[model samples]
Target: MGSPAMADGYINGVPVDCYCTDKQGQRIEVGETICLQVDGRMFMAQCQMSLNVPMWREVSPGCLSSGLTAPLQSVDPSIHTLGVDVEIFATKS
Candidate 1:
């Protein structure tokens, strides 16, 4: 798993739940996994909470395919797609 830096946020003196954001500024809820390509390398990543902070942990050794069957929660009203090699399925909330 890749160790990415994490930063937390606060609102009105209350700590808020952390969410993972991609390059396109789409928010991914915790416990969700997504295929990401960083530094020209593709990997499967999941949003996890560690030590009260949210971070992306690599789950798969490498990306095998583009189709992801995991159900996704809608964070944005507009539909979006990742790279040509990655396909994301999201349901409107």
Candidate 2:
């Protein structure tokens, strides 16, 4: 999930254990098997996945005598991808 904050946070309650030093540096652990069904076809795969939230900023001005405030924000899973070898199962007649 996405949240507005200065530091990092979790996604779907899953913790980020590893860090990468670059434009993008975050890792997520997903289960081995993923299943998808479309129309009457079923697909299964063993996959690796990731979730990312790009960094952002938000500025808010106070009313009256109050000063201005700037807060950091991030988008939830700005990018998500899955890589795996998929298998298609056929039904028997």
lDDT on C-alpha atoms for all candidate structures: 0.72, 0.35
Q: How many residue pairs clash in each candidate?
A: 0, 0
Clashing pairs in 2: none
Best model number under TM-score: 1
**lDDT by residue for model 2 (1-93), tens:** 355331244555676543322214323223333333445544553333334543221122221233434431232333431322234344557
| Model 1, span 1-93: residue lDDT tens | 223333334544566778889879899998889988999989999988776677889999677675654554343335554422332454457
Which parts of model 2 are misplaced by more than 4 Å?
1-14, 17-29, 51-93
Which clashing pairs does model 1 show?
none
How far out, in Å, is residue 55 in model 1?
A: 0.7
TM-score, structure 2 vs. true: 0.20
TM-score of each: 0.51, 0.20
How high is the lDDT of residue 47 in model 1? 89
